[model samples]
Target: MVFLLFSAATSFAKTPLQPILPLLEAMPSDLHVTVPYLLSFVMADPLKMAMVSIENNLSPPETLQKLSESLTSLLPLLSQLADIIPRDALLWKLKLLKSGAAYANSRLHAVQAEVLFLASGKDNLLPSGEEADRLFKGLKNCRVRYFKENGHTLLLEDGVNLLSVIKGANMYRRGRQRDFVTDYLPPTLSEFKKTFDEDHKLFHLALSPVMMSTLTNGKIVRGLAGVPDQGPVLFVGYHALMGIELSPLYEEFLREKNTIVRGMAHPMLFGSKYETSRQESSRLDTVSMYGGLPVTPINMYRLFERNQYVLLYPGGAREALHRKVCLMSPYLY
Candidate 1:
């Protein structure tokens, strides 16, 4: 008894629903406003049809059910018209029914369900047993039930039955199953120690002997032997040339200490072309191989966004290429 009507001029008229009416009206001359019109003629009552159209287009599951109920109200009228209508008109209605069945079947197949309710008898809308059967067979775990006594107006003729079927399905049930000891146990000290040792083994395997020796020798030479092994620390150093003189030594020290150091280079160095044996290309690939990345204007903002440790040499290539003896003065620029 709850009537939900729409405004005379609504947005649904400009959308997907617009094509439904025109297509139905164009169905052969024999049909007039018969079976196909049952689906299409809702436009005659524009206010009510517009609301149903909108709900069909954008409503959630519950709202869609309510809209379906409204559409169901017209089934008895459609059934009577089908029985009395001319043969050619009846054929056109059948065409609309087949088309509608295909559309509904496509929608049902998209959902994960164990059972499908299908209408197989005549009414205001088309019967969809064949399409429903195909969809049910394709589903991994689902069965279809065809209501021979029902039509598109199932909710109108027998709302209680529909409600009972929906309740029996229990599709709304959703939650965790149970909790057990496996869910909350922490690793024992011995197990934790074994895991840590395995990780350390893998780390050592990844480093070369040369890299390991340099790291061990550098710590002793630089008076940093007392540093604790609690956790890794970021080490930043200033280099005097394009390739740092201490790079080989630092690399070895890092390997021995089981740590990583990333070096940043100017954008210009990566953008420029370099000559090789076969042809000339950018040096970015070579730079990346040496564990260094070119910092360009495009990615400079992203570096700060990720809170990366950045290295900047304001002097760039110009300072490195100059042969003049330069003083280490901050005001030289």
Candidate 2:
């Protein structure tokens, strides 16, 4: 098992080892541990909790009755496990969890390597959040991502998208170093559908914007017919009122022009503060997936060099939130 795990870690082309809850489930399935603990740890009242989860859109409709039925089914299997496994074996496993971290703490500082610590806020089984902070302080190159509502088994839970987390952290790269432009991943068809149909569905319907373009002769035309049918185009516009204009602008180009606007976005959108409280899916993720790069001179240059359509907001927050001055002034700031 150790060899296989090591091989799996090394096979990924120098990706660092991620040790998450090592030996977490190695306990022998004795009735004392499995029967009572498993039942209470997850579902004290399976049917009731299931109903609550369903009502909150956390689980499917069928989960209510089905979960209760599943719990009943677990009894016989747990009984079988109690008979098969020794009680002392289970007790020793329990002992390990109590002392495992303390044992590892002294040795951890000796190992100098990059670490990504994922802390679960509601982890019932362990003090994950506190441990993560401790590890972050001790380790040289450690970064932490906290999942406040998640448990120890967050990977198997619903709405936990790992790729999105990695992307939001700006940790996606092909080589040793990072390159924002070359490393950016465009939104897939599924992502596009989700963003339009699910995320911004209401906004798209409410606005139903009318797009128009003008020619060099000052002749106006309906739709994007007058717009260039090529790349390297820069669309500069006012960021009116909390950037509500962004959605339609991006969507219309996608729907009609078949273009992904590489908007030079502010760092605030991609910062850690946003990720700490974000749950399940986020519009910020959508922004990044749709080619929203950090507002920097190099990023803009890169987009133009690649012959990609670019979008920029010169005024930024000053224009979006405090628009009265921008409205009165003939010249844009």
Candidate 3:
């Protein structure tokens, strides 16, 4: 879904890769041909870049060489994409699109929901401390969990956990002992062992595995010392890098802290909750079992009122596509 948009919009946008004029000239007018053609090219570059990084330890010359090659390769794909949409149209939209909410400040004070501000200290797109502080002050009831060393994608980054912050403290005072722990059932011991062994092997090969160390202000956090041992905590944070950090973040929390974060996902994830399908999909089934509900104000409110821990990335797809450096936010998200 994202790659297709990238292909169509790259010609006019300030993309990392430049357009390939020859490929553009050769492309058919049909989008069907263009999408797969671009996809074919996208598949190889990341692995190639990773291989170069691992082999050369990301030395400047080697890295630049790989980058140049990758960009050169992308020319054909972008050229093919430009056939479907004019570069000028994409450029115009990119320039005019609002990156954030303009009227949020005026409306936020009217919100009665207890706010949990999860701020990333080194966030690039938004100043984490400043934004969190602003929200904290604006809202009638709010508490903050500041990660001094993390960037915008704090949860996705290594060594951070939702459980680490919300384990003990009664963050919100809801009268009933609403135990929605059943909404999040940790994987069985056997299931966990199998998943861990598989993920350990996979991430090592894919990410060039490294030990995770949670730090606060350059000091190591050994246990739940930084977190309040409590219930019904909701974590609000920004999304980054297409929310690529989610799987690792969720996996780590389950593995180390024995907690499952009920991620409030987009409605698309559940495949039309209103409709019933006789044809079962393994992918959708797995996601449903993982406890990803459609995002709604009611869902969030109920979770908090019930004393269940909830994780939210409010930025949606816009934030994920807001790329800057290395498909990541420079110095932040």
Model 1: per-residue Cα lDDT over 1-333, one tens digit each: 111111101112223344455555566755654653555442233224324333223449866676676667655655566457764665576466556645654564465544434334332233244434444455443433344544444443432133233222221122341111112122233322322344233643554223211244354334334443433233444446644433343334343544323345554343212212112112233233223445455444444454433344555544554535554433234
How much is 180 displaced in model 3, in angstroms?
10
Q: List the RMSD of every prediction in angstroms.
A: 25.6, 8.7, 18.8
Model 3 residue 123 lDDT?
A: 50
- Give a tens-digit lDDT track for model 3, residues 118-145: 6665554345566655655666655555
| TM-score for each candidate, following the candidate numbering | 0.24, 0.64, 0.35
Assess candidate 2 and give its lDDT: 0.60
Comparison by lDDT, 1 against 2, better one: 2
User: Candidate 1, which segments miss by more than 4 Å at Cα?
Assistant: 1-237, 275-286, 296-312, 322-333
TM-score-superior candidate, 1 or 3: 3
Clashing pairs in 3: 124-332, 167-229, 167-230, 168-228, 168-229, 168-230, 169-228, 169-229, 169-230, 232-307
Model 3 spans > 4 angstroms off: 1-186, 208-225, 272-286, 323-333
lDDT of 1 at 83: 58
Q: Tell me the deviation in Å of residue 41 in model 1.
A: 84
Candidate 2: worst-modelled 10 consecutive residues by lDDT: 1-10
lDDT of 1 at 160: 17
Q: For every model in order, what is the number of clashing pairs?
A: 5, 0, 10
For each candidate, the alpha-carbon lDDT, in order, equals 0.39, 0.60, 0.48
Error of model 1, residue 65, in angstroms: 83
